[model samples]
Target: MSVKIAVLGAGSWGTVLADLLANNGHEVRLWGNSAETAAEINDHHTNKHYLPDFKVSPKVVATLDLKSTLAGVQAILFVIPTAAMRIVAKQVAPILAETGAKPIIISATKGLEQNTHKRISQIIGDEFPAELAEGLVIFSGPSHAEDVATHDITSLTVASQNIGDAEWVQAIFMNDYFRLYTNDDMVGVELGGALKNVIAIGAGILHGLGYGDNTKAALITRGLAEISRLGIEMGANPLTFMGLSGIGDLIVTSTSVHSRNWRCGNALGQGQKLDDVLANMGQVVEGVGTAKAAHELAQQHHVEMPISESIYRVLYENANVQDEINKLMQRRGRREMDFQR
Candidate 1:
């Protein structure tokens, strides 16, 4: 069955996803804040600023009008940055109420609110009514926009509180090149997606500092351990961290050049200032903000996350990257399998 979907965002990931849905025979309304991007997508079938070489499907309509974009749509997918998530959700709420539209909410954005430490789904739920928010779906995994643009095989997890909602999303997004699995552990799935960005920064730091495979392997291993520890303390399923959203996400984001977080961390590790690194990236490096939120969450829960803590200091406190790395190496060793703080 064909569905009318509103995709909110025009970044590389958003454009690619909109095109994918259009290719799958869905009517896609892509909304972005920039009129220039919207015009480019509609007139040229391209989003040169984000995905320079890729052509957007002409079937997808790009617009800056949120009200029109949501009009009669059955699903809305948010691919915006975490900082903008709440504001956008607030705007969408009144519009939905006016239209009486009960669309399925899907969040592809990954990051906890820096102030409240709430997940993306929680933020959306806080803005929208219970009826519209109850079945919200979270899309996450190791997939990257660059790879997906070229039709590289990509698998993702679509998790929801309601299993039926997740399966419905899986059906819409599944294709020969794009595969989605349904999981009901929304808490674990969101945390794994958000927290892995922080670990990826650490991985990029190691690479920027000229560390080899052995050191990178150790950091990734230890990073997953801390991520799992904090996640378990926050009411997430332990086994979920072992799946696609957890270890799989960490490995890809940390190692791939396509990751904005990894690239930002690489710039910082090379002694560039945070402001300069961010300005140059032209995209949001989610890890920079997620590191702070993860740090606060760890403190509140009394969880030991030394790697994330060190990353937080390095990014926010003007601490030297090498000095932080030294501190991590000098910390007291514990059992490899220990989850207790």
Candidate 2:
């Protein structure tokens, strides 16, 4: 059964997913924001911006027109960065509502909206009415676009308030090259996706500072404890953090060199300015925004996420990173702490 699918965004993940689906015999259209990128994908079948070496499948067509991107599509997979989601959603909502397509809308971006503190799904729902917001899904987990392009063993979770709709997403995504799972914990899955980037940055800072495995281990472990604590307070299932999107993503991102947040932190640890690192990468480091948001969330909920708080101060308040580290390490506190809290 061939499904008509359109992926909005020609970045690494979008290109990789377009390839996976096209190779699996689906009609896949890739939409790019830039005319040059759209041309590269349509004419050359390559994404010079993200994945330059790999050639995309012929079944994958690229378009610059938003209306063309949504034409005859059964599902819309949004792969744009979190910062650009609102602009993209505004463009799609009218098309989706007027055309009566009501296609399954899935957001692949990870990170909360800084100003509104809303999740991607929440942003979409707020932009579109309930009738337009139906069939919403979030695709996230430990999967990285670079590794997935190389046919690595990448598994991820598809979550939605609607289980039946999420199952549709699982069916469309699962193939021999990639495995998929269905989850109902939308909050846990989403927070894990958005929050791990901040922890990964901290991990990179530790690595750049000549820290050993023991130190990295502690950061990863304790970092997860903090995320779990806040996530539980925010109505997320505590056990979800122990699953694929939680500890699994944190371990992979903090340990690997592929994470953009980790790379940004590595530069920061090497004493590079935030602007310099971001200018060089030419990509959004979601942790930069999420760090502050999570830090604010912690303050609002009276949850102590020291790691996040420290990063927030270092990034926003211009606090000394070394001093922040010391504050966490030598905190005057009691023992026998519950990992849950």
Candidate 3:
């Protein structure tokens, strides 16, 4: 069955996903804030600013009109940044309320709200009514836009409180190159996706500081432990952290050059100012914001996340990266398998 879908956000991930859905024979209306991006996608089937050297699917219609984009769509996928998630959801709420549309809401953006420390799904739930938000699905994993653009084999987790909704999303997104698994642990899935970005920044710092494979390996492993600790405290399943959205996401984001968070940390590690690095990236470095949220969450939950705390300080408090690293090394050592503090 063909589904009509509205994909919000016009960045690299959004464009690639819209093209993928169109290729899967769905009617996809891609909405972006930029008129230039919309015109380029509609007229030339290209988004040079975001995904240079790639052509968008001509079948996908790109538009700047949000109301038109949501008209009669059965599903809406949000790929925007976390900072914009609430505002966009608020805008969509009134439009959906006017049309009496209860579309399946899906979020691919992975980051917590900075001050509130709320997940993407939580933010969406706050804006939309219960009927529309009840079956909210989260799409997340180790997949990157650059890899997905080239049809690289990738697997992701689609999580929803309602299992049926998750399976439906899995069916629409799964293809030969793109595979999705359904999970019921929305909390674990969302946290795994969002928190991994913070750890990836730490990984990038290690690389930028000329650390070798052994150090990165240690960082990734220990990073997962801390992430899992906070996640478990926040009502997430312990096992979910071992799956695709957890360890898998951390590994890829930490190592991949395509990761904006890793690249941002690399620049910071190499003595570049945070502002300069963000300005040069031309993309949202989710980890920079996520680090702060994670740090706060850790403090609130009384969870020991030294690595995330150090990264947060380095990013926000003008702390020296090397000095933070030294602090981490000097911290009291404990059992490797101890998750409970």
Candidate 4:
């Protein structure tokens, strides 16, 4: 069945996903805050700022009116940045209530709330109706918007507490080139997606510092370990870290040039100021904010996330990136196979 969906956020990922859904025969309405952006997408079928030289599906419509986007929609996908998620959700809740629409809420955005350190689903649950919040589905994995826009072989996980909801999402998104697997571990999936960006930034820093494959490999591996440690402490299944949202996400984000977080970290590693790097990138480097959340979460959970801590210091404290790296290297070493405990 063809489902009518609303994709919030006009960023690269949102545009790509809305286009994909349109191409899949679903009626998709992409909502953007900027009228100019909506006009460009509607008139030209191109989000030039985000996806230059890439054409969007003509079947997709862009809208500035949020209520219209929600009308008769079967599902809503939130791809906005974490910082803006609450504001958007607050604006959306009353509109949904007024319109009497109860679509399946899906969060593709990754990152914990700044001070509360709540996951994206928690943020949504805080603002939306109870039923929608309880059944919220998360879509995450190693797929990049740029690659997925080109119909590249991309696979992701759609996780929900409700298997029926996950299967519904999987069915809507699955195609020859785009594939999705269902997992019940929402905590693991969300953390895997959100936390990997921090590691990817570290990977970028290593790349920018002229480190080779061996260093990258070590960072990726150790990054997964710390992420898993914190994730496990938060009640997520340890094994979920080995799956698509976990190791799969960590590997791709930390290694790929398509990663904005990696690029942001690379710029920082090359000695660019955080503000300067973000201004030049023209996109939200999620890891920068996520690093702060990770730092706080580690402290809250009494978990030691050395790499994440270093990255956090570099991003937030104006600490010398090289000095932080040196500190990480000089840290006391321990057993590598201690996760099973």
Give lDDT: candidate 2, residue 19.
93
**What are the RMSDs of all candidates, in order?**
0.8, 1.3, 0.8, 1.2
Tens-place lDDT digits, model 4, residues 70-94: 8999999999999999999999999
Q: Tens digit of lDDT per residue, candidate 2, span 1-341?
A: 78999899888989999999888778998998788887877788888678767888877988888898898899899999999999989998888778778788888899999877888888988888786465689898888888888889988888888889899888877887688788889889989989999999999998888888999999998899899988999999988898888998898888888899999988888899888899998778999999988988888888988888888887888788899999998876645257544
Taken over the whole model, the C-alpha lDDT of each candidate is 0.93, 0.87, 0.93, 0.91
The list of candidate 1 runs beyond 4 A from truth reads none
Q: Which segments of model 2 are wrong by more than 4 Å?
A: 132-134, 333-341
Q: What would the per-residue lDDT of candidate 3 be over residues 1-341, giving only the tens digit for each residue?
A: 78999999999999999999999989999999999889999999999998889999999999989999999999999999999999999999999999999899999999999889999988988999988788999999998998999999999999999989999999998899999999999899999999999999988888888999999999999999998999999999999999999999999999999999899888777888999999999989999899889988988989999889889888889998888888988988788889974
Question: Where is model 1 poorest over a 10-residue stretch in terms of lDDT?
Answer: 332-341
Clashes of each: 0, 0, 0, 0
TM-score, per-candidate, Cα-based: 0.99, 0.97, 0.99, 0.98
What is the C-alpha local distance difference test score of candidate 2? Answer: 0.87
State in Å the error of residue 15, model 1.
0.4
Q: Which ten residues in a row have the lowest lDDT in candidate 2?
A: 332-341
N/CA/C clash count, model 1: 0
Clashing pairs in 3: none
